[model samples]
Target: MTDHIGTAPVRDGLHGGGRRRELAAATVGSVVESFDWNLYAVLAPYFAADLFGHGKGGVNGVLAAYATFAVGFVARPVGSYLIGRLSDTRGRRLALSLGMAVIAVASLGLAALPGQRSIGVWAAVLAVVVRVVQGLAFGGEAPSVAAYVTETAPPRHRFAFSSVSYGGIILGSLLSFGVLTALIRTLGKSGLENGGWRWGFLVAALLGLGAVWVRRAAPESEEFHRARARQRPGGRPPFLRTLREHRRSVFTVFLNTLGGTVGYYFALTYLPQYAAAYHVIDKETAASFMTVVLAVVLVTMLLTGAAADRFGLLPVARIGFWLPVPAVPVLLAGLRGGWLSFQLVAVLLGMLVATVLGTLNVFTGLLFPTEVRAVGLGVVNAATIAAFGGSFPLLAEWLGDHHRLGLIPFYVTVCTAGPAVGLLTAMRVPSFAAAVQEAEAGIQRTPGSA
Candidate 1:
């Protein structure tokens, strides 16, 4: 059968060696992006006193650092618009390379920055600036990589390939926590606070540079090349056209993302900080727990992705969404009890969230056509994550201060419900992926096409 004008020909289940090379590059690029973005979370406790000057250095100091962490996400939406547009207009390979370059620079800046003792508040200011740049880079990196992986994979294996993108994030978290655990074991608390944390940022910088080189050598996706070739001489910007034509798709993707974002941040990323703040566990213990949680999540994610390929995206997504609603309250109750319970429940929660993330990348990629897929996914992802995911740490901190910590599980439950409902509504539309494919075909057949 002949291929569609702007689409690559579908292949069998097995991928060629060249396609495998593209996957490896995208995976490494994603790992570097995740490491750069999340490294601050692991080190925040040690640096909070020096950077933010929170009195006697307790929960308040950690909260201040987390606040700075949250501020970084504020730039994500703007970055998504600018960099996602670049991917649409230029090429995925260029966007991936450029984002990694920015990440490397920002990671190096963080490693070299002086504390408040040297530059006073400027140290904090500089930290936030580097974080913003990192956020911007990540905003571009995720969608382009996801789109590239999805568009390049064979129809029978798209979910399996796309799932590897999220696996990079799990591995990045594991690496960050593993290094922190080892540092605490070797250097002890005071030593880490004094200077040891900088090494982690330095490692991230080196990894980011390596990923930039890898992505630079990777080939551009055939789908992107075909779509670019068919662009009209003068037309509306892809972002604007996406808004005008694909509003429902954009909204569906946003709703689909809400549950996974809230669950992952609250359950995995912020849990360590919360444990340290409440004195439920030492920093080293928290790091150890997260290391284990990440290992479980990585395995679960790969399995869930394969399940999506075998069963269906919507079925896997629905299971992921609803299972967590009841499980969260029970886990939170366990968390309030003690450290052992916290570790066990946290691992279970991570696995549940991984199932959602497993299929989400492919589901969102199929929502838009090749021409606007990157920007559409990026804009929706950045907005929802900034609004809900990034703010969860700060919000939980405030709630804990107000003696309302028990409400967090209920908040997560509500967020999970949105995706379950949104996805069911989305499936009601007949052949949603087919509709996107047909739209791309229509664009290719437009009059005066190249």
Candidate 2:
């Protein structure tokens, strides 16, 4: 099962076309899930005035809108716990289907909900509620899908396969950017304010439904089935078991994700807003640039994953996390000046961020065994993403408003530094990949007795 790339052997019972189908289902579902989740952020500025009203209060209104977006992150950890437990107890296919169903309903809800003019603050309230639902669903969806892909992939190809989920995310963002750019050109600002933003959400809802249908036929991960069968009846819940037994893995993942999530949000999600807010670029231009940046990221992500398979995960991950440390400051310096310089530096930084995230999902999945894999990743990812990823834009906006724009790059540098240090330190201990292989071997040996 081992390959020339030095990846562990592929697990039995999942090979050939069967594995490809599972990866396809998982990738499509991820794309749809991310599309639904990111639609609001992509269209936020266009819809802000409608949802929160206009005037000087408009600035506060946009912030409020972003705050509502962050509210979804607040619900992620809860979703992670509940859904992760469900995935461990039930099955990956069921958990994924249910998560996609929630995303579909939530996206459609956002699409159909009344605006502030029609319902006053209630409009914002309802939006927040829908975001929470989406957040919860995503909390479960991301980790479960990552685990499923890793478990089912040919061992040598796990990194590449796991990158598919990240690819879906980038593709989703690219789709959002394309839709937004098209809407801007066709609708203009007024039309977008009138009702055009809803189209994005509506489209996401449809795609989510399509993803659910596709996922319904996906085969359950063989590894999950084997792991579940190996668990003793009435044993402790997976979450608790994970906390007690895999504390180091959980902590390591948290530190690693803190950097990756922060870098991702800072570099990709908030870049357009940052450019617009600081007058570095117009909104339209920023969106166009972001579309290009996302395309670059998508390519870099896949390449980094492939590299991880050939080289070692630690070395690849180290390069990803460390490169951004020096690059962030240089990019920020460029942003303070000419547009051409800013765009060049920004693209370079975007690629660096993509490199980190490209390998991160697979690396995180390798940190835990099948028994606690889903919950372990869900909790750690949910926690970091909520705390760092969710707050990134808000924090950047706040800093910009206060004339502390200089602090932004430093913030990004600190975030990246922590994970770089953690990765280097962890490399000295039991390797995460080896630990994962050992755990899998143990499961194969004792089919009904963990």
Whole-model lDDT per candidate: 0.78, 0.77
Q: For candidate 1, lDDT tens digit of each residue in 14-60?
A: 54776777788888987887777678887887988777766453457
Q: For model 2, state the Cα shift of residue 198 in Å.
A: 0.5
lDDT, candidate 1, at 21: 72
Assess the local accuracy of residue 263 in candidate 1 as a C-alpha lDDT between 0 and 100. 84
Show how many residue pairs clash in every candidate, following the order shown. 0, 0
What is the lDDT, from 0 to 100, of the residue 249 in candidate 1? 72
Worst 10 residues of 2 by lDDT: 1-10
Tell me which residue pairs clash in candidate 1: none
Q: lDDT, candidate 2, residue 134?
A: 89
Which number leads on lDDT? 1
